[model samples]
Target chain A: MKHIIVYIEPKDASSLKRTSYEALTAARSIAGDAQITAFAVHGSEQALATAGNYGVQSVVVAKHDLLSTYSSTATAEALAQYAQSVSADTIILSGNASGKEISPRLSVKLKAGILPDCITLENDGGTVKAIRPVYAGKAHIAVQSISDHSIIALRPNVFTAKQEGSANASISSFTPNLEAKHAGVKVTSLVKNEGRLDVAEADIIVSGGRGMKGPEHFPIIEQLASTLNAAVGASRAVVDAGWRPHGEQVGQTGKTVSPSLYVACGISGAVQHLAGMSSSKFILAINKDKDAPIFKVADYGIVGDVFEVLPVLDAKLKAMLHS
Target chain B: MNILVCISQVPDTTAKIQVSGDGKSIEKTGIKFILNPYDEFAIEEGLRLRERFGGTVIALTVGSETSKEILRTALAMGVDKAGIVKTDDILDSYNVAENIAGYAKSISPDLVIFGRQSIDFDSSGMAPMVAEMLDLPSISVVSSWNIENNVITAERDIEGGKEVLTCSIPCVISAQKGLNDPRYPKLPDIMKAKSKPIEEIASCHGSALVSLTSMVLPSSKRVGMIVGDSEAEIASVVTALHEQAKVI
Candidate 1:
């Protein structure tokens, strides 16, 4: 029996929308006979209760004054304390902003190994192996954690949460003697990106590149996205040119998203760009060049003009949805 | 003020990439190592901050002694001193950040800086992890920063836009591109860099915490069918997109 824990980020729950359940799934899968403890920092009880529906046996709250703010060290220290208390063999964290920040710090404190941005995880006879992207998304690396303590940052959108029953998971409190001087960084304000779907949470995304010509040409992608109720994205080239916001950029430098379906428009698949979006469940590429590398990874590819094609597809989609 | 900038050695982006026979590691043939593009931004910002307020800027790198080349480059760019945490080990970013934070604390700098992410292993988690270890306030991917009365103001990239933040001094910041174009090293500065002090502290602990078990390259692509050409080809492509791909 192995015990697993999830370091939850409450603020990102709504933004990420589904990582709690996914984290639970990964935790349960890894923990055979052992219990699963879901830890949420300075968040409400409702958030912890929500964990029960996802099969978490208990919830641990690191209730403290400073927990309300984002303290990488404090959060890491707190999680490390909880892991020690529960004797967790593995710690599961959602591959979101907060988890990404905390997992490594916790790994350092515990002297544990960390598998980052893993698309999948499995345990074989007390050995936890995680699959991650390597070679800039051109390859997959399967890594095994040999340390007594292990951390896995599950790639978002790979696992859909399945609910069993709702119950009050046994809740406990945890507090780390956080040095006041050490709780330094704080998330003063989160300038939430509005009007577009979060790539991390989106089921489908449509991304464009420099081939769109300019920022003005983005209306076509927006229209297509609007018709399909999909998220919008951009290539590094477009973001580099300021044609799109940096958040919209999908590449190694930008956000790494794993959507159910990804439509790449007018973008040649550069390796750096593909590393971020290669985990998409279904990839469709549209470009004018027949030899673009994206077409190799794309399950479906179209070499033509995005400008004329998007509107027609939008209209047909609207007609089909209306019909 | 004491500022430390952590630099990584990476192959030039424009260079061709060749993988090993098994596709596990990058083939270093013909590739030249340079200071990470983002860390260069960190070095420039450190120099800028030092010039604005008389301070010491020390550049550090975690690699073999040859990695000191980038430190030398930073020193030539007017950084006061440089150091190399010589290790041929590829520690996970966590271990790397831990080693860096420990070394930084040993020096007791007023501020620490690095790029948002390194090119080789772009976890983008190094700065935050270091901040976490030291419990230092941090703002990442900052385009602008200001220092006044022991407080630091900065900005970071958010989902849709950017967030502006202010924290106390002795903070950490990960540099974002366009923060400042790194300045060219002058001959006088290059000559002076030869005389700068440097230290190599070999920490025999940590590293090799995580081992890459297996790896595979991306599957080869199929020769996709080209429907037509130009704007008119878009209609056929869209039709194919709906009927064949069903993406619509």
Candidate 2:
């Protein structure tokens, strides 16, 4: 029996993210006998076409007024309906931003158990055992739910993207049974940083800590990230200092990122911060303090000033790209 | 208009947590419970809104009797009422949400507010579930809110930036930090909190959506190599990256 993956569509307002495609490839690993269904809880024809490229067996859009605005409650209720409709034994979700907000609720709606922040998933007999980091990033624990319909939220970038084949699944719309009170809390506005990649969805990222001094020095780190086409991240200290927004922070209290390449310019790698990004495929550390905890997890270490090292590395990368 | 604030009584971020004798959970000895930092922002916003527009602020928590102590903390900060859905054992996030939704259904407040996610479990799902169970609109990671008659203006932090939203009232909004600095409880307010009305509810014992079979502490650090201070020592250190550390 193959596992089914559900790429929960947020209320089709925001642009589609790369994590959606990455999640489809992850579902392929488990989608064999049981076909995978990529669901759009509140998407339109344009959103459906946008989701087509992600290699999934089918894209089912639950067209409903209840989904008019994004609500974890509405999404959970809608996805629960789909899970039962298809008799899906295993449901895979992205452990990034949206998944963290809704997976627990969806599991409740379906009376299922979820293994969250799972970095790997495999079939065990009829059960799905998942590997996830626990007690921060110091250890990895394997969880096997002794229950029916296990929900697993995979960490971003943990599974390699394999979209060679297009599943090109059928598209359908669903209307949810929305209640009036459910529409009570409405969003009035939005604010966001421009050009930078979604920290959780980035393939490469460069983060700075309070060691970066202030917001004035963040531009250097941004320059390095721009050179690599990577994302920008910050430590709690920097965020608390008002040098960066809380969204850019990486820690137990911040956004967790698992990029292919992670460059820590001034971060000391506090346990909380490491819990967010320690799963990266490769990590590079450049700090003035050699004893920074980040070096413990780094694949490459550079002990020097970030101001001096960043420009040099940026130049080297530019030269390599030009040459 | 009335506003309900769902608050979680969590261990202070600075609290020292250690494994118990059996190594199964955080040691409970001498632990103090406080309002979840994120929820404090929610409660504070509720109070501020009430002050400006004239509404009641009600604080609620689902936890043991001892956890209710945090309610006084909220009351001392000028909240109108406090409620606790009594429960013991590690109630999973889903069950907690079910209990909260039940509470919301009975009270039927015009507006509900919650922290985007709690510090524990890190699931951040309860308020949304309650809103859904009641069939209300909810916005997560909400950093700002402005109310105008029947409509509410909210700001949600999305990937790369924020999206300004305009939704009607009677909705759920999860307060993100930085939206406002939680007001400190003054001496007079703290004294008056003892007189504030508190209601205790029976545990709903609803089935939780997720469960933690077990929890264990992380492994200890293997070894840490320290570097010397000085410009001359830099070259030898670079050598260790390729040699001893095998990281270059």
Tell me, by TM-score, which candidate is best. 1
Model 1 ranges off by over 4 Å: A11-16, A165-170, B14-24, B132-137, B159-166, B184-199, B220-248
Q: For model 2, what is the error of residue A50's alpha carbon versus the real structure, in angstroms, after optimal superposition?
A: 9.1
* lDDT, candidate 2, A1-323, per-residue tens: 45474765543554344566666776776665667778767555555554555566467877677676765555666777777777877777886656765676666566666777777777656566676765455445567654577777877668775555543456776566666543344333445565667686677888999778889999999998898788888988999988987788887767778777778888988777887788776677788888788888876667778777777767666654565
Error of 1 at B66 (Å): 3.7
Q: Which tens-of-lDDT digit does each residue in A1-323 have in candidate 1? A: 37788876554433224776888877877677777788877666666667777788688888777767766556777788878877887888887766766776777667677888787788777778888765466557788666787888887778667776777567788886676664666666767767668665677899999889999989899887877788899998999888987767788778788886788999998877887888776787778788888887877666667776667556655765676
Highest lDDT: which candidate? 1
Clashes of each: 0, 36
